[model samples]
Each structure stands twice: as C-alpha cells, then as structure tokens.
Target: MAASPAKKRILVGQSGGPTAAINSSLAGVVAGAREAGAETVGMRYGIQGYLAGRTVALGEALPDDDALALLRRTPSSWLGSCRFKLPALDAPEAEGFFADAFAKLEADGFDAVLYIGGNDSMDTIAKLGAWGARMGSPIRFIGVPKTIDDDLVGIDHTPGYGSAARFVATAVSEVARDADVYDLKSVTFVEIMGRDAGWLAGSACLAGPDLVLLPEVTLDEDALIERISVLLEHQNTVVVAMSEGVRGADGHLIAEKTVAAGTGVDEFGHLAQLSGPSRYLAGVAKARLGVKTRAVELSTLQRCASHCASEVDLDEAFELGRRGVSAALAGESVRMCTLTRTGDEPYAAEYGTVDVLEVANKVKPVPREWICADGMGVTDDFRRYVAPLAGTLPQQLKGL
Candidate 1:
C-alpha cells in the first residue's frame, strides 16, 4: 500500500509587542495545524530565538483542548517576542544571515513559516518571503496580524485592538467618574498607547471623554489650553484622553519637545519613549490655568488586560490565525491574513489575504473624517465603527 502523505511541518513566531489576544492567535494556529495532521513548532522568542536555536513543539506542549483554552485566556506572547530587525535582502549584512536562516529552515523540513505581529514584524515576513523567492526556497512565509495600535494596513482592525480599546474606554470611564467626586476645578489627562496612529486614544471617546487628542491631528497647544479653560468654566472636572504620540504642527512629537535630552530609538527606529506627552500637557495646564491637573499614563496596562478582553476580538484573532495557516499550507506565500468588514449592524467580518509587501512598514491612521472638526473629539461615525469591535462595556453608577 502507498504510504500516506508526510505530515507538513510549520514554524510560527510572535514578535513586536504583546497583547491580550496574541496568545489566542497562537493557540488557533496550533489547533488548525493539528487538525490538518501537521506538526507545529514555535520559536521561543521570534526569529532571533530561532537563530539561537530555540523552539518548542506546540502540539506536544499543549496536547488537549483544555491547554488551548487556557492559552487563549492568557495574555502576552506565548512564544515570547522580540524587536530584532532584519537587514534588507540586498544589504551586505543580509547574505550570511539569509543563507543561514534558509539553510536552517530547510534543514528542519518546515513546509511553511508564519509570523504573528504588527508593522515591524510584517517587514520581517516581507523580507524573508522575498529572499526565499529569490533563492527558489519551497517554504512559504506568511504574516498573522496582532497589535493593540489598530494601525495595521489592509485589515478592518487588528485582534489585540478590541481588547485594548475596551480597556481604555472602561478605564477612562472609571477615571472620569472618580474625577467628578469633588467639586474642584480639575483637568485629568489620560495618556493612551498609539504611536503613529490615534486609534487607541480615540477609543476613549466610547466612554465620553470631554476631549480626545490624537496624533492624526496636530496639537494646537494654545487652543487645547483655551478649550480646557472653557470646559472648566462650565464643569468642575474635565477629562482628556490623549495619544502618547500627539505632535505639534511642526511635526515633532510633543514628548520630545517636553524633554531636553533624547531617549534614542529602537531597532525599528520608533521613539523609545512616548510617555511624557500627557504629563507635559498636564503640567502646562496646571501652570497656565492654575487648576488641579493630573496625568495618568495607562502604560503597559492597556495591552494585556485579559479581564476586559472583547469576545469578538478573541474570536476574530483565533479565526485569523487559523486562516493564515490554511493559506500558507495552500501554497500561498508573502501574504498576511486580512479581515474585511461585511456588515455593521450585526458586526460581521470575513477573513481574507493581502500581500505582505503591501502591509509591511505601513501605518493606518484614523481617518480625518472620523475626527470631529475641532480635532478634540471623535464623530458618531467613529463610535459606530469601533463600538462593535469593543463589544459591550459595563454600565457604571453615577452619584449626584
């Protein structure tokens, strides 16, 4: 009798930042590969770890449904992550690196390799896929999207964004209620995570912040101070949700303008620090308006709050992971899985694929139309766009 087809082997890695739903996507890949009678291996800490020869047999590690269920609920990258940037395919440094990587991948008999990450990670996939094509390698390379920024191009929204957005909205709402307790004129600036785009900060509008500052719109410093002054004239407390990357019309990050020295950049060239914007804005308000001002930087809390995770987000993340694996197994390469929004009322999404080259190193910013004319708030259309992904938030009690 003819022997059955040999089991296809796949290698997957998580890179860049961690999110509440990133592990769920990893679990989905494992489940999908197992169902197809394939072997699934995970890089211990992305491509860098693989080069260091570290990997885990995921199927053997989590052999049952219960383990996968736990993995889905777990926040952060299950396989660890890194920010190691790869050299360009034609760069002098890439020759040895690409040769060694492809040799190792082929030596281990991986039929396909996948990366789960955001923009920078997609860049890795694009480079690897291009290199593989040039060398006529058989192993396919694919990208699975994961980011709290919600700035990945070619997808309606990313998996981690839903959970992060929900957390931001809930946290902002709670903070707003707390700020209202005393009858003192106060302004609280809640800084959220979002570098090039303002999706996360804009999400604070779901909780009805008095103002939402986004990087997409240049900061009018005088106007912001005046707006807060006017807001305090009518109310005892004013809450503003601002993106950490908010910049001035001069096209420089407000955080950089706040501090004298530089913090340096990451391997991917993004600012190593985007935390000072809210504090700077708060200090400015306190000094100028003479009101009680406080800055609250959500920091890392926004990305991995599994308790506030949106069901829709987790479900979509898992489904996308599965679809990505299927696409790679079907001989597709240099592609990233995408989600096309089909319906808004019931909130339906369809899984698809987009060329990884098209998505890599690109940022999808919040649409100008979504921001209010004054650039201080989001429109109802923005709410309609994000509310579904964020799912239902808790209703809080208001005291008179």
Candidate 2:
C-alpha cells in the first residue's frame, strides 16, 4: 500500500504594517487550515515573536464562526506585527539563530509556516526557507501580501490597497470641499503615504487634485509653484496631492528639510520617513506664491479606517490568505500567493504563486505610462485600471 500523506501543524503570523483587511486574511488562513485537517498556531507578533517563543493557540483563541467573523472586520494586525529583518541564511550568526527558531517550531510541532505581510515579511519567508533547506528540515514557508503602500511585487495589487485607496479618494474629495469654504484664493496640500512607491499617493487622482506627484518622479518645486499660481488665477481653491517620499531633482527627499532631525532608520535600513513635505510646501506657497495655504497629513488613518474598507479588498484579502495556506498544505515552500489579473474588462483576478525570493526586498512602483506626460495628473487609462478596485468615488455635494 502507498504511504499515507503526512499530517501537518501550521503556524501563521502577521508582520510589518497593518491594514484594515489584514485580519480578514488571518481569519481565512485559520479557517482554511482547519478545513485542511491541520493543527494551527498563531505566532504572536509574527516571526520576531515566534523566535522569542511567543505564540497563541489559534483554535483556542478564535474557536468558532462568530470569533472569526469579528476578526475579519477588526482593523489592524490581529495577532500583532513587527518590522524585524532576518539576516541571510549564510550569515555568520545564522546557524545559532536558526537553531533556536527551528527548536521552537519543532517543540511546538509546526511543520508549515505562513507569514502575512509585505516586502520585509517575504524576506523572512525566503530566509527561513533557506535555513530549512540547509538544515534538512521539513518545514515549509509561504508569504501573503499586505500593505497600504501597494508596493509588494509579483501581484496585480495588494490586499490592503483598494480599501486604503478608497479612503484616500473619499478623504481627499471631502478635504477639497472643506478647503473651498473661504472667499480667499487658497492652496491645499494633501500629504499621502508611500515610502518608495507612489501607488497610495497616486490614488488621490480620483479626487481631482490639480497636481498629483509620485515618488517615481522628483518634485519640481518651481513647476509646482507655477502650476498652483496659474490655478489660483482662475480658481478660488487648488488642491495638490503628493507622496511622502517625493524627491527633488537633486535626488534628496523633500521631507529631509522639513522633518525634524534624529528620526531613526527601521530594521529594513529605510529612513523612517516623517511627515512634513505638505507643511513645508504650505509655508513656501504662503511666502512665495502669496496664497493662503494649508496641509493635511493622512497619517495612520489611511491604513486603519476599517469603516471605509472596500468589500472587494476584504474579499480578495481573505481569498489570498486561503490560497496561501492551501498552497503550503499542498507542499509548496518559499512562494508568495499573488493575484494575477486575467481580464481587464470583466475585472477578474486569479490566484497564483511566485517565488518568495523574487518578491522579497522588491518594490513595485507605479508605471510611467499610467502617469500623465505633464506629471501632474494620471491618464484615463490609469482610471480604468484602478476603477474596479476603488469603489464609490465621492460624489459632488448635492443641492444648495
């Protein structure tokens, strides 16, 4: 007779930044693992905690449908999150670190691991898989994408992006109306979040900003002032949307001048980008352009605004989680679950997998073609590309 397929113990964790739909993905992983006849453990605060031997008995913590349902709607990282970057398996310290981590997993009877996060989380997966192979361990690792920045590679778009984009669209439109409340010609600068990619900031285009600056292109301050001045001559209010990481022609962050000193770097070696470009521009417009100016920082509100979450985004997030777990249980490792867009007209996405190494530490920026020639607005093609994902653009205020 053929040997029986091996039973497995699966562990899941959340890492990096959280989003409105991240918990939905966790719930999906839990439910899918249970259905696959696998024992499940929740690594509290992700792999960082996993190494420290922190974990929760998921079956005991979220035992039923009601608990899982509540988890899906709850915003932020359900089990918690971390930004810890693992060193390569070939590093001098690797053997000692992997020994402890592998010992913990073995003691806990975990044979499969699922990491839900964006870029850095994938890096963890890739490194763990390398360690597993080197040690001849049977443990498998998989990555699930999650980020409001939408910079994760090997996917059409990420789970948290659509909902965050929806929030950006509505919030910008609402702010635009708020800025129009005065008789004086005013310039409003709306600051958006995107450390290395401009997808999140670009979503504000749907809200009708006179200027939409992406991180892909360096900011032209003179051009920006010139544009705003021209807009103010004809319009009472002009709103501009820009990314946090927008650089100058000299390849320096505009935030470098305005963000206070002593901001430290994260584990990923990226400067902990502070919020100040909008305020800086507001001051500049006041001094140079001679217009009333204001700045609005979207901040963490963008990622955790679950009330404004998109049903489409939540659904996809859940599906991706299930698919990632399913792939792992079927004996895949070092792979990331991805959503491949098969058709644009019908707007469909199919589940697929890409090597985690290809995705780890990689950033996907907005396509240059999607950005307009003038670099101030996005093209009609861009609208169609993200339209299905971004639901219910804020409507104009009705009636006087």
Candidate 3:
C-alpha cells in the first residue's frame, strides 16, 4: 500500500486582551497560513478553549472578504478573550494539562499553533511549545505580540500601544485646546490606562511639552493643587493628564486604592472595577483648590478606537503576524515574533524571532532617563521614540 499524505493543520488563537490592531494580525496570520498550504483553525477563546476541545475552521469562522475587512478594522478580539493564567510548568497539574491538550491537537490533526497576545500570552506559547518539543509531538508554536500596555520586553513596542498612544495624545491635545478657550473657572483631569507601567499616560506628554503628568515623577499633591489654583486664578482653565497606575509616596496605585471595589469578579478572581484617581483628584481640586473640576476617563476608548489607529502600527502588527507564521513554517518553536528598532531617524524596524521565555510575563518599564526631573513630563527622547509610530499627521479640521 502507498504511504498516506501527512495532515497539515494550523491553529491560531487570541490569548490576551484585545487592541485596535489585533484583528489585523489575525488577518495576516490567516492569509499566510492559507498561502503556506496549511488548513487553518481558530481556537475559540484561547488556550482554555483548546483544553476544553473547542475549535472551529478558520475559513468558516472568519468567512470571506467583508467579514475579514471588518475583522481588520475591529478593535476588540472578535473570537472573544479570556485572562486565564496558565499554571507554572513545574506544577503538578501542568504535565497532565499538556498531555491532554497535545493529544487533542494531534487527534485533531493540528501541526502548528500561533497565539496572538501580549507578554502573558507569549508565556502560554512558550509553555506549550516546550512541552510539545519534549514530548516529541510534531507541533510548532509561534507568538504574535499585541498589547496597549507597551510593556513587553525585547520588542521596540507592542502593536496596540502605538494606536492607543496616538489616541491619548490627540484627545489630550484637544482637551488642552478646549481648556485654553474656556473662561470658566475649572480644572480638567484626564485619566489614562496603564496597569503598572505608565506608557499610556507618558504618551500624553506628546500632546505638548508642558501638558502631561507622569507616574515616573513623585508628584507633590500640594504643589499640583497650587499649580492648578494658579492656572485657574490666571487663565480660568487648566487641563491635567494622569495615569491610572500613578503611585503615591508609599508606592500604592492611587487609583486602585481609591476606586470603589466592584461587586463582580471574573474567573480569575480579579476585581472588575474602574480606576478612580481622576475622579478623586477632581474632588480634591474642587474642595481644596476651590476650582470646578471635571474628570474624563479615557478607558476602553484608547484600546478600541480603530478609526484613529496609527497606520505604522497597523502595518507593523500585520507584518509581525506574517513573520510569525513564516517562522513556525521554518520549524521555529517556543519563539515570539519581534520587531526591533534598527534606526530612529527614518523609523526602521528589523523583524526577527526571540525566545518566548525571555519575553514572557516580564514587563519593561518606561526609562527613567526619558522622564523629566519635575516628574510631570517626558523628555524629548521619549517623544522621539513615539513620534514615528504615529506616522503622518492628520489634516487639521476647520469649523464648517
């Protein structure tokens, strides 16, 4: 009897929180996998879904042109998402989980897997790939980067961060312009998202040299009040940018401690709540600084504003996904697709693969050198790092 042809199957999943460019990465992965003669499959939700034996054909799930186009423009994860943290490889349950998952993949004829997500998601890829290699399972795994936090190490910046930063800077600049025109005695505090790192808030510094407040600086609350008082006394309007992760002298998240604890909890037992630092600061300004205050939480808008996405970020994200597929086809396993800055002048990126273990679950903080001494702004170097990511400036709009 003649030998049978080997099954060629590829599995792709979204593993972390969504971003504006996540779907672009997905599109690239789908297009590349199909071109490489592999039957592409999508794991519903994420690794958890794989463990539970839930999956669908990529062609059926994503459909054709119009749906794929919508996927490209959609902000959040279209396949849905979860924050299930995989247990450490050394844990007792880890081996059993891997055995069962790989058995399922092998039975289902999956030869490769690609996970699109941020640091933690890459960790999942590393774990599964390493286990598969050790077990001699013929499955290759690749990781595609995605995060608005911009904290993933080794890469120049995560895909979603550029678009989010662009949105933040634009909104902050517009708020500043609005404040400049108003004669009403009020203080506006704009709060941005950044869990532990301050990348999102730091981007607000790009609005202008003097318009941002960063967590990197140990801010004096009294001094801030005085400054706002002075601004309101003289100009009748003041706009301030703040990070949700801003820490006090004790190093606690100002917003985390102040926000009202939500009654809800997810599967991870993490609190489901919004940061309250901006609202808290607004109250303080109104009470102590004797100025009317307004708070604007630029929460989900930062991550989901596909309409305001940075073209550079989108292109890079898609390229990263294609490269990830290529690397997997080349037999690269336990690796993440990375884009490193080759030059700052013309904004060049060199795509390559790095050990996912090296980049997984570890955060890269905003450089101290990039923070201004007063702790209220970023230096020119920080701006240089982010400016090119925004691509060309948008045309200015005139009142009709």
TM-scores, all candidates, are 0.98, 0.96, 0.92
Backbone clashes, candidate 1: 0
What is the RMSD of candidate 1? 1.2
Best by TM-score: 1
Which portions of model 3 miss their true places by more than 4 Å? 1-7, 62-70, 230-234, 262-271, 397-400
Point out the higher-scoring one by TM-score: 2 or 3: 2
Quality of model 3 by C-alpha lDDT: 0.80
Greater-lDDT candidate between 1 and 3: 1
lDDT of each: 0.93, 0.88, 0.80
Worst ten in a row by lDDT for model 2: 391-400
Residue-wise C-alpha lDDT for candidate 1, range 108-226, written one tens digit per residue = 99999989999999999999999999999999998999999999999999999999999999999999988989979999999999999999999998898999999999989999999
Cα-based RMSD of the predictions, in order? 1.2, 1.9, 2.6
Order the numbered candidates by lDDT, best leading: 1, 2, 3
Write the residue-wise lDDT of candidate 2 on 58-155 in tens digits. Answer: 89999999998899989999899988988777789988888988898888888889999999899999999878988888888999999999998899
lDDT of 3 by residue, 1-400 (tens): 9997765788888977789999888888887776776678887888888678678788877767677667777788866676777767889999887778888888888778999998778888888888888888778989999999898998899999889888888888787777667567888889998776778888877676244666666567787887777666667777788888777767766776676655465544434664888888899889996767888898888887887799898888888887888898888988999998998898898999889989986888888889877677778898899888866445551122
Extract clashing residue pairs from model 1. Answer: none
